[model samples]
Each structure stands twice: as structure tokens, then as C-alpha cells.
Target: MINIANTKTSSTEQKNTPMAFLELAFRPFFLCASFFSIISLLLWGAMLNGSFTADVYGGALWWHKHEMLFGFVSAIIVGFLLTAVQNWTGVRSLNGKGLLGLFILWLLGRVLFLMPVNLSPWFIILVDITFLPLAAAALAYPIIQVKLWRNLMFIPILLIMTLINIVMHYSIVSQSPQLMNNASTAMVLLVTLIMTIMGGRVFPMFTANGTQTPRVNAVGWLEKVVIITTLVALIISFNIIDLPTEFKAGIYFIAAVAHAARAFRWKVWVTLKTPLVWSLHFSYWCIAIGLLLFGVAELSATVSQSQAVHLLTVGAMGTMILSMISRVSLGHTGRAIVASKLMTFAFITIILSTIFRVFGSYFLTDYSQVINTAIVFWVIAYGCFVYIYLPILTKAKPGY
Candidate 1:
């Protein structure tokens, strides 16, 4: 659905940029998202150890969950979409002062959430909910101008995420922890759906190009089944409909099977030699496994929902974000797409972090230690990214 082939910036469009970093949405958003993720994770670890105390709005736990989704992940999603829409429609997206204003708007939401000064809950909600809609508008304009109807699906998804964010804030005002948890789970499922759709588009293409293999053709029926089942699972996760546990479990299992089968057609085995390609395959498998485990959690007494969620969060989302940003940054910036040695190690560490976060509770007696260890791996993984990519992100692309 994305026109990966049409990524070159026209000279006329390039003339509008005042600075390199602010020239494209991906530059600032990716940099900020990576740094914020590390800071958020460290604060989370400190919160677990009882060392960090901040009078963050919505309490610490709620801030951690909400910020990771609406704060960190949302930034990356906006960045990727805005940048990709340019390629899809051959229309320039937000850039220069306009892009900076949007970035500042997003930053204000994150800052207001953690500021020690007491603030009206309504004011914060207004600031936070405004980013996505504006971003959706920025994204929608280009597609509509070019009549790229197929790419328009992302606008509604962004608006829906904004709606979920509103519900999350309302849960805090209502003092309903259950509602907050449900909203968070729904947000996670919604992100998984985004990943599912995007991965289906790019994984086979990336794998084939990286490995010099023939691209696998998608079966129309199977593709439809995958999207339909994922939508059902997402609806169930929202807890809007009162579905039985068995019925919910059945939907999850069907989604899981559909994802796994769809992934198999992507030629995952051949990607192992290429970290950039295989990391994506590994992350997609995490989604499939996470969905299956989610079904098991619903049906079985032993498996907790939290464990499955960590797999999707730390494994699927974290790894995939790192992989995508790494590759996208290089390609867009006019560099070769090869992963550096340190970057490759970063990829491996993130995968380890996911494994520990998801399975460590089952094998280890001390849950705190499991979480701490997972945090350490995560820090190392993302730390490598910041260290290696800082210069690449800040400096102008060679000969630009």
C-alpha cells in the first residue's frame, strides 16, 4: 500500500527546509522518542525500587503506562506516518517551523504530565489530546490532495487512538483503575493492529530485497482473515462488549493463528543472516506468540495477562520500533542500509530484554529481580542506539 519506490525529495520541496534536523518529521521525532523511552524506563525502574518519587499526574504507574503509549510510541507513529505519507503521495509533509510547532505541542503534553506544579486535569487533557488530531490533519492533507485513498486508513486509526487517550485521562478523573487498565490494554492492541498492517506491507519486501529472494505474494483471503480477526481481538480488548472469556479466547487464538500463518509466508528463515531484516521477523513472531499467550491467559488460570502484554510491549513494539527507526533513518538520510556492529548488538539485546520480561516471572522466584534484569537489558539495547545514532541523526546527510 505504501509507495516505497517514490521516496526521493524533489528539489522544490527541499528548498523549504531551514535546518536539516527540522527538515523532516522523522528526524526530530525519532530522536526524541528514543531518548524519552530510555528516561521513562529508568524512571520506571527507580519507581519499582522506591527510589524515585515525583508528584506526576495520574500517579506513577499510570504515568508509566500512559506515557509509553501516548507519549513515546505515539511520537514514533506520527513521525513514521508523516514521513511515509510524503513518499506515498509525493507531497511534502510538515517541515521547518511547522514541524517544530507540532513537536513542541507533543513535548508540552509529556512535560505537563510530570511537572511537579499542580495543574488542572482538564487543561492537561486538552493539551494531550490535541497532538494526534493535528497530526492526523497534517497527514490527511497530503493524501487527500493527491487522492491517495488507500493511505487514508491511517487517519481514522490516529483519531481512534486519540479517543482512547481521552478515555485513559477520563479513567484517572473517575478514579477507576479498572477502566484505566482496560484502556491501556486497548491502546496496546490498537498499536499491534497498526504493526500488523504495516508489517504485512513491508516485511516481505524488506526480506526479499535484503536476501535477494523473490518476494512472496500475499493471498487475498488470508490477508482479509488476518485483518478481520485482529479487529475482533482489538474490539474485545476494549471491553466495550461483554463477551464471555471463552469467546474472547477463541478470537485471540484465531488472530494468533492468522498472524503466524501470514508471517510464515514472508520467508522469515532467510532473514536470519541480516539483522535488519531478521529483527523485524523476530518482532512479528513476538506479536503472533503474544496473541497466542493472550488467549492462553484468558483461558488458563496460571498465565497472567501482564506477562503476555510485556511480550507485545517489550518484544513486539520495542524491537520493531528500534528496527524500523534504524533502517528508516539510514535510508531517508542517504546512507547505506547496513546495520553497524553495535546496532546489531543492540538488536540482539532488545530481543533478550523481551524474553526476560515475558518469561522470567515463570522461572524466577523473585519477581523484582526479573524486572530489574529486564530493565538493564533494555537500557543496554536502547543505549546502544542513542550512542551510535546520535551523530547520524544530528548531522546533515552526506552531500545533502
Candidate 2:
């Protein structure tokens, strides 16, 4: 005889089993983002050191740049938006099978790009560029259901990113190296704009919440100025070749001052006691300093553009992503948002990595040695993340 009550109970338990890890967007996506960052950096460092000298899709250097911009960073963006939309709308996004499918699409994109298979251009295009739009679709239902018009801004940003990815793919497929470089730079600037917007919202809140501060000091006019000037700078950055050198430097210089002035209002100094808090502040500081140096590099011969970009990438994006994932994974998993001692050291190493990559490479004569040192710190920073957070990500929630 079939027991109906027992069968229902068994099914309920099955749904709440270890599979609950995938029930939220953060679990699988954060794990994948961290792991992919580690593997990609390993490959990039090895290539720089003459350890492996083979191209993946278009060329070795392009492959590295493309994956970091489109692959790893995109994964983080999707994870964050998916999880965030659910919270914003009080509606459920993808879970279980739907979430798994989205993740598989991302994984397949990585594979199709790196694997030594001569797939058709259209096939690669279908695989590489489909993930972000699907993610947007997953969010659109909830966002539109509640008439969240203001939040619709992210949809266009995601679509632009998708278009940029497509342009990058076309460049590679058509064998246009110059187009690929321009698209890659555009993608970098686009991601930076996204970071700037999100950081402005969260960093202040996190600082106030973490430090038990009563106020978040922000001026409305200054905030609007920051956004407007940042947009102007991004437009010029994308069209940098057409613009004169002095104009580019002037735009970037204004952006640097605006960013630094805004960051000063965020109460960064009070949060220095907490690793999780200060890391966010320090990363934003990098963006401001990097922009200033980026403008200076355009005018002078000593500080290279490549060096300035590394500061933004390694110092700003890399550290901010690392710190954010650490905090998000813990809080979402129902754990206390506190950093372990080892994790604090991990944070320090990443900051050091950025300093070495930017300043050390600029000041020191031996660039190779500077790069090698930076890579070691980068690995250790992410390596600690995998070590500390793997179990947190893979297992079911502590209470569950």
C-alpha cells in the first residue's frame, strides 16, 4: 500500500536537502566566480612567465583579457543581480533547475571559448553571449511585475554588456585585432561604470551599518555631479582615439577629483578597524587614485596606461569583488559577517598585490619581477577565499 503522507514528507525533505545550496543565486554563482578567478589568474600568470605559450581562441593575450572582462567579471555581475532582484521585488527569481541551467550556460561559455575545438562562429556566438540576456530575463519578470521603473536601468546596462560581448566575439571571428582591443577597453570602462554606481549605493551603507555610525554623509548635488561627470568620462574613454590627449586628460582628471571627493564623505576612516569594511573603502580609493594616474599617464611618458589599468583592475575591481563575495557569502548563508584572521591576511595580500602591480612596476626597473610578485599575492588572496568559503558555499545553510 502507498503511504501518501509519508511520500509528501519525503518529497519535501528532498527539496530542502543539500540542493538548497542552489536554491539561491549566490551559492553556485559565488563559488564558480571565485574558482574561475583562481584558475584564470593561474593561466594568465603562467603565460606571462613563459610557462605555457598557446592561444585559446583568438590570441593568447586577447583570450586572457576577454575572459577576465566577459567571463569572470560577468559571472559575478549575474550572481549579484539575480540575488539582488529577488530581494528588491520580494519575488522569487530562478531556483533549482532554472538556476542550474543558468549556471551551466555560463560554464559552457567558458568551455567553448577555451577548448581547442574549431567550432563555427555562429555556434560560438550563441554559446558565449547568451548568459547575460537570460539572466536579465530571469530578473525582468519580478522587476516588471512590481513596476520597478527605476531599477530598469540595470536592464539596459546588461544589454549593453551583451552587445559588447557580441562585438568582441565578432572581432575575434572576423580576425580584427584592433576592433577586439577597442571592444575590450570599452567593456572595461562599462564594467567600471557599473561598479561606480553600485559602490556608491552600498559602500556607504555598509560603513554605517558595520561601524554603528548614525549618519551617511552624502550631498545630493555632489552625487549628481559625480554621476554626470563619470558618464562624460566614460564616453570620452570609449572614443579616446578620436579625442585629443589634453581633452582626455582633463576629463579623467575631473572624474578623479569627483570620485575622491565623494569617497571622502563615506566615513571610510572609521571603518578601518574591520577588514571587511576597510577593504571596500581602500578599493574605492584605488579607483580614484587610478583615475588620477590614468590622466597623468596620458600626459607623461613615465607612467604607462597599462600600469594605470592594472591598478583599476587589480586594486579596485579585484579587491572589491573579493571583499564583497566574502561578506555576501557569509551573510546570505546565515553566518556572521566577520572575517577570520586568515581572511584578513588574504585582504592585506590583495591590497599589496595592487600596490606592487601599480606603483612597484612604475617605480622599480624590473617589471617582470614586479609582475611575478603581484601574481603571488593575487593567488594567495583568492586561494584563501576558496579555502575558507568552499564549505560555506557547498553545504546547506547552517540552520537547515
Candidate 3:
């Protein structure tokens, strides 16, 4: 069996002793995510209220979106993936200088994004787009050596996301509104695709394992149809600029069937017992619901696309990512499956935050209020994630 316990001295460790506040997976980025998330949103709030003064290369909206995706999400992605890749592969993993370098690359991206004119587009591109793929490369190296090909597909997705991000930047520089809109839609679709594939594999698997039952790998014809439909819809949605509404809705319905099948595959009856596991199943369901609603918006002319997207972002993505980070960090760190009360509270906070965000999306007539409400959930969800995982990441897994 693969060893989940990590014992090496963390980079945060100094002179044969563990460092406080820097001891585990959650410490550094939780602090970073905590501070950066607040600051990023505050800047966003200011940008919206006509008070924020920072002009990141392209503009406030561009900066806000770019940093939110590339910086904040990227940082969290690296921290979680790097830490887990080590545990997943039993490799020594990136730490010490290697870890430090990756973190610096992330910081530099932020700095370059903030200073608009000093850097060329290429300069900004180099800084912003380099980290995730590099992190993926770092991760894949060990996994590939061990023949973990299944996980390798994530590399190309990471690369494509990087490419899309670059396109977003250059579209800004070129003043190509068309290209910018295309890139924007592509990025969101990429996020959706990620939700589709990763959620498919992990959600059911985690639910089954967490609940101590038969592996609920829903294998059947409907599941196969769902998978196929999801790919077709995602590609058609992203590729076709003015796709016919009827066609898009058909694809969305197929994908929703698939997503819901995946969610239901692992009997949620077993899940309700564990909030951590149930939260994941719940989040995946939200993705299905959001995608279908998005398709409905396109076809029926009733629902708003923005509403569908937020359901994924504020509801599904936020919830699922936080739940996984908490569970993975704890499980890999040699902690028991049982979360501490504080950790449980943190998870609850994120859920409540998600409720606020999703409800605000529909109820709050003002766009700014919607953004404000979403930010709270975003911060709290991630904040709670960081709150629990920081120690788990910093310290080596419990058993030496």
C-alpha cells in the first residue's frame, strides 16, 4: 500500500524542530490565501465602488479577474496539489528551495499584474502563466516515473488553462473585445470541464471510501451517455460562438444527466452520515444543476447565464475544492478521518457562506450586492479551508 504518512522535515522545519505557523500544508497558503483573498476582494470592492486605485496591467476588471483566477486559485491549487502529489506518489515531493521557487513565481505574478505599464505583455505572460503548468510538470514527473498515466491528463488541462489565461491577457492588450469574450468563455468552460472530470472520479470514490461501503463506481449505460454528452456540450459550448439555443440545451441536459448520475451513483444515504463526504456529493450536484440551468438560459431565454456560472463558482467549485483540501490534507497527514470540531465548524461556515452567495445571486437585485455576498462566501469557504489545512500541510504526515 502507498504510504500516506509524510515524515521528511518540511521546508518550514528549521534546525531539527518544527516551526510554528509554518509547520504543515495549510500554514503558508492559508495565511497567503487568507490575506490575499481579503485583499483581492477589497481591491475588487474598491474597483466596483469607484474607490479602488490599483490599475493592474489591463485594467481593474481584468486585474481582478486575472488575479482571482491565476493568483488566488493558482496558489491554492499548487499548495494542495503539491502536498497531495507527494503523499499520492510516495515521492519526496517539492520542498525547501523547490517549493520556495514555485511560491516566488506566484508572488512575482501578483507583483507584475499590479504594475501595468512597466512590463511588456510577454513579461506579464511569462510571470502569470508559468506557475500552474510548472506545478503540473513537477507533479507529473514523479507520477509518470511511477506510471501514473491517469493523473497525467491533468497536465495538459493545466497547460490549456495557462494558454487561455495568456489569451485573456493579450486580448486585453490588443483591445480585441471579441477575443477577450472568447477567452473569458473558454476559461469558464475549462473550469466546468475540470469540475466534470475531477468530480466524476473523486466524488464517488471519496464518498464510498469515506462511508465504508462498496466502491460506488456507477458503471452503466446512462453513466456512459452522461460522460459523452458532457464532453460534446463543453466543446460545442466553448467552440461555437453563437451556438443555437436548442442544441446547447440538449447537450446541457445530457451533461446534467451524467453529473447527477455520478452524484447519485454513490448512495448519498451513506453520505449524510459524514458532512465532509456529503459536502462533495452535494457540490457535484450543484455543478450539474448549474450546467443544466446554464443550458436552459441559452435555450429557454428565461434563466441568466451569470446565475448558472455562479452556482458553479460560488456553490459547486467553492464547496468541492474546500472539502477535498480539508479531507486530503488531513487524511494524508496521518490524521484520523474524524475532523476536529473547529474543522467541522469551518466546513459549516463555508456551507453557510455558499448559501449566502447562491441566494444573493438570485435575490440581490444589485450586481454589487451579489458580488459582495459572493466574496464573503468565497473568503469564508477558502478561509475555513485554510484554517484547517495549514497545520496539516506544514507538518510532515504524522507517522515517521
| 10 residues in a row with least lDDT, candidate 3 | 16-25
**Candidate 2 colliding pairs, count:** 0
Rank the models by TM-score, top first.
Answer: 1, 2, 3
Report, for all candidates in order, the number of backbone clashes.
0, 0, 12
Q: After superposition, how far is residue 376 of candidate 1 from its true place, in Å?
A: 1.5
lDDT of each: 0.89, 0.80, 0.68
Which candidate wins on lDDT?
1
TM-score (C-alpha, index-matched) for candidate 1: 0.97
Query: Per-residue lDDT tens digits of candidate 1, residues 319-392?
Result: 99999999988888888898999999999999889988999987889988888889889889889988887887
Off by over 4 Å in 3: 1-31, 240-242, 395-400
Q: List the residue pairs that clash in candidate 1.
A: none
Give the Å error, residue 2, model 1: 2.5
Measured over all alpha carbons after superposition, the RMSD of each candidate to the real structure, in angstroms, is 1.3, 5.9, 3.6
Q: Which digits, one per residue and each the tens of the lDDT, describe model 3 over residues 15-134? A: 333343333334455457555866787778777878767767877767776676667666666666666566667665665566667777877877777775766778778777888888
TM-score of each: 0.97, 0.93, 0.85
Model 3 earns a TM-score of 0.85
Find the 10 residues in a row with the least total lDDT in model 2. Answer: 1-10
